[model samples]
Target: MENGSRISGDRRPQVGVAVFLLKSSSILLGRRLSSVGYGTFALPGGRLEFGESFEECARREVKEETGMDVVRVEILTVVNMVALDGPDPTHFVTIIARAEMADSGQSPANMEPDKCAGWAWYEWAQLPQPLFGPLEDLLKGGFNPFAASRLM
Candidate 1:
C-alpha cells in the first residue's frame, strides 16, 4: 500500500477500460462488488489484458460481466485516476469508451453474480450512485456518455 498513489507491489500503473454501453439515450450501469468500489454504480469494465486492445477489453468485459455483446466500440475519453485518499494510493489509467448492443433481442444478464447485481440503463442525468471513482472523476471532468444518436 503506497497510501493512495500507487499499489504497493506493482510499480506500473493499471490500465483498464470502462464501457458506456448505450441504448438510444440511456447508458448501462452496474453495481460494483470490488473492494475499491463496493456498492457503487459504474460502467462495466476491467483491467486491460496483456495483448488486447482497448475495444477488445471493452467488449470482453461487457460480455463477461453483463452477458451482452457490444458492437461499434469507440474510445470516448481517457481518464487518469490518482487515488490518494485511502491506506493505499492507487493510480489507474482508464480508457472510457462507448458501444451499442449487438442485437436488440439480447438483454443484460449478470454473468458475474459475485461482482455485479445486474446491469440497467439510465439517462445520464439520472445515473445511480454512489459513483465509482473513475466514473465520478469522469463526470466531474464533464465527460458525457450520451449523444449517441445512432443508438436512438
Candidate 2:
C-alpha cells in the first residue's frame, strides 16, 4: 500500500473502487457525502493509491469505512464511467469487486462520517434511488454482482 497516496499522472483517469459485500441476501450500501456524488448510494470504497492494487484498495476502504474485515476479494467487473450528463464532466475507471465478512456477526458502522452518512444492507432488487455515478452505470448495464453464474 502507498499509504493512501493516489496515483500521480495529471492525465490519467482516476482509479476508483467499490465492494459488493453480500451478507445473507443483502449487500452493503452507503450514502455518499462527498461532492462528486453527494446524497447518492455508493459502495464502500475509495480511490486506489499509488502502488496499491484494487484488492488492497477494497479491503482497506471497507475496513476503514465500516470497521469490518472482509475476505474473498474478487473482481466483479470494471466500469468506464464518463460523466457526460453533468456540467463538471468526470471520468473514473472504477474497479468493482465482491467480498464477504470474516464473521457474519460483525456489522458495519459509519467510520468515516465525513465521507458517508451511514451503512446498511439492502436487497439487490430494492436498492436505494440515485446511486453513485459508477453504480448507476453498473445497474443500467444489468451487471448483477450476486450472480456467480455469469462469466465476467
Candidate 3:
C-alpha cells in the first residue's frame, strides 16, 4: 500500500465541517494559507474530531481559526467532494453548518496566522473572488447560506 493509503485498505472519505457564521447581511470568511486551497476564501472549519458531533466540530473549528464564539450551530448541507486530478487527490465529505456569533458586537481575530491570512465579513452577493473548492461546489449545488439560514 502507498503511504497515503490506509494499511487496512479502508477507503472511507474524510469528514470536514465548515461554518456559515452570519452577522446580519454578512458572513465570515478567511483567505486560506494551506497548500490545498491556498489564497482562496473559505469559511472557518476543519476535520471533525473523533466522537465529535457536527455542531461541536463547527463551534470548535470557528473558535480555533477565528477566536470567536459561535451560537445556534445547525447543519445546512453536506457535500461529497472527489478531487482526483491533483498530486495529492482527496475525497472529503464536507458538512456545512450555519452559526452566529454569541456576542453580536464581537469581531473575529486571527487565531491561527499559519493557517489563514485574516478574517473578514463580506456580503453574500458581493463575496470575494476565488472561493475554496468545497465552497464553490456547495454554491454550485444551489446551497445558499442566507436562504438556508432563514429556514433554520
Candidate 4:
C-alpha cells in the first residue's frame, strides 16, 4: 500500500482491473489462472503496471487475459477492496470497465496456463454460479457508473 495507503497492517495492497466486455448482449468470463483465486470465474482483467493510467491498464489487461481486443472502454465503477478482508488484510482497487469486444478472433494469449483453466461467454441472466467479486458487484448494479457518479 503506497499512494493513498489502503492496507491496514502488514498486508500488501494489490491493484487490478476488471473488464466487462459486451458481445451479442453477453459478457465474457475468464477462469482464474493463478492461485490468488485459481479456477474461479471472473472478468477479463489484471494488475496495473507502474505509472500506467487506469484506463490503459484496464484495456491491456483485458486483452492479455482474455485474448479479445477491446474496441471501446467506458468506466463502469470503482471498488475499493482495501478493507474487505477485515481491518488488516490484502487490499485491491477493482476498476470495472464496460468494453465492446473487437473482431480479432484471437485465442487467449500470454496467459498463465496454470492459473486460468477455462473461458466462456455468458448472458447476464445465465452467468455461472459463485461469480467472482467484480462480477458479483456488476450484477448487483454496483458498476452503474453514470448513475453511481451522478453523471446522468
Candidate 5:
C-alpha cells in the first residue's frame, strides 16, 4: 500500500513488471531505495499500470527508471510471491521480461534517485548480493534470462 492503494480490505495482489535488459554478457540492475527492498539489487521495472500490455509496461518502466530505451521486449516468466508473515501481508504477481538497449552505447542514468541508488551492468553468473525478493525467487525457479533470450 506504499503506492496509496487501500490495504484494509484489498486482498488482491499487485502486479509488477521486471525487465532483464541484456547487453552482451551482462544484465542491468539497480540498487533499490524503496521501503520494501532497500539496498537490494533489482531489475528496472515498476507496477503494471491498468490497461497496459506487458510489453508496454516493460518498455515504459525501463525508460522511466533508467532513462534508456529498450527493444525486443518480451515476457520471459512470471512469479507469484505471497508474504503473509509481515504486517502488511502483501502479495505480488511479478512479470519478468527480457530486452536489449535501443542503443548499445547508451548508458543508464539514475532517473529516480529516490527509488534507486544507481544502475549498473552485471554479469548473469555473478549478480550483486541481496537481490530483490521477486528476482531471487526467479533465480530459484531456474529462470535464466540469458538462456531464455537466446531461445526467443
Candidate 6:
C-alpha cells in the first residue's frame, strides 16, 4: 500500500461520515450500537444516504445518533480505509468534520442508555480509548481548529 498504510480484510468500497462535535472544551463521542464496530465509541456519523450530500449526511447522522443538532460543519480530515482479505476488497472514505453544538445536551431516542449507551463530551487532550480506528489517530495528533494542514 502507498504510504505504508495497510488493509487487513476484503472490505467493499463504501462512503462513511464522521463528526467531531465540540462544546465548551470537549468533543462529542457516541458508542456504536449497530454496525461492524458495535460496542466501540465513535464519532457520531454514518453512511451517506442516496441523494444526500456529504454535509447533509453528516448533519443528519449526528442528530440521529446523538440527538444533538449540528450548528455548523467544517471539514477536518479525510481518511481512506481499505481491507483486502475478503470476497470483495473494500475501500472506505471517511470524511471527518467538526460540528458545533446546537443544544445543551441530549441522548439517543428510544434506545437503552446502557445499550446504545450515552454520548459523552470529553476534553480533547483526555479522550478515552477504543474510539473507533481513524478517529483515534486524529484525536491523538493534536489537531487544531485553526491549523492549515491536516495530519496524514
**Which lDDT value does model 2 have at 18?**
88
Expressed as tens digits, the lDDT of each residue in 6-117 for candidate 6 is: 5544535788888877667777776766555567778778788889877789889877776667776777688777655444455678887776767655543523454456
Q: Give each model a TM-score.
A: 0.87, 0.87, 0.89, 0.74, 0.89, 0.73
On lDDT, the stronger of 3 and 4 is 3
> Could you give me the TM-score of model 6 versus the true structure?
0.73
At residue 84, give the lDDT of candidate 4. 47
| After superposition, candidate 2 runs with Cα above 4 Å error | 1-11, 84-88, 149-152
At residue 51, candidate 6 shows an lDDT of 95
Worst ten in a row by lDDT for model 6:
143-152
Q: For every candidate structure, what is the RMSD over all alpha carbons to the true structure, in angstroms? A: 3.8, 6.6, 3.6, 5.0, 4.5, 5.1
Which lDDT tens digits does candidate 5 get at residues 1-152? 56664456759889999999888788899999988888999999989998999889999999999999988888877889987655667788988888878998999999999999999999988999999998998898888887874322
Which ten contiguous residues of candidate 1 have the minimum total lDDT? 143-152
Question: What local distance difference test score does each model get?
Answer: 0.83, 0.85, 0.88, 0.66, 0.88, 0.69
Ranking by TM-score: 5, 3, 1, 2, 4, 6
RMSD of 1: 3.8
How would you encode candidate 4's per-residue C-alpha lDDT over 1-152 as one tens digit per residue? 37765544566667887777665656677777554554668877888889987778877887666666776677766777644454444568887777666664654553656657667777866778777765666667645332334111
Backbone clash count for every predicted candidate, in the order shown: 7, 0, 0, 3, 0, 8
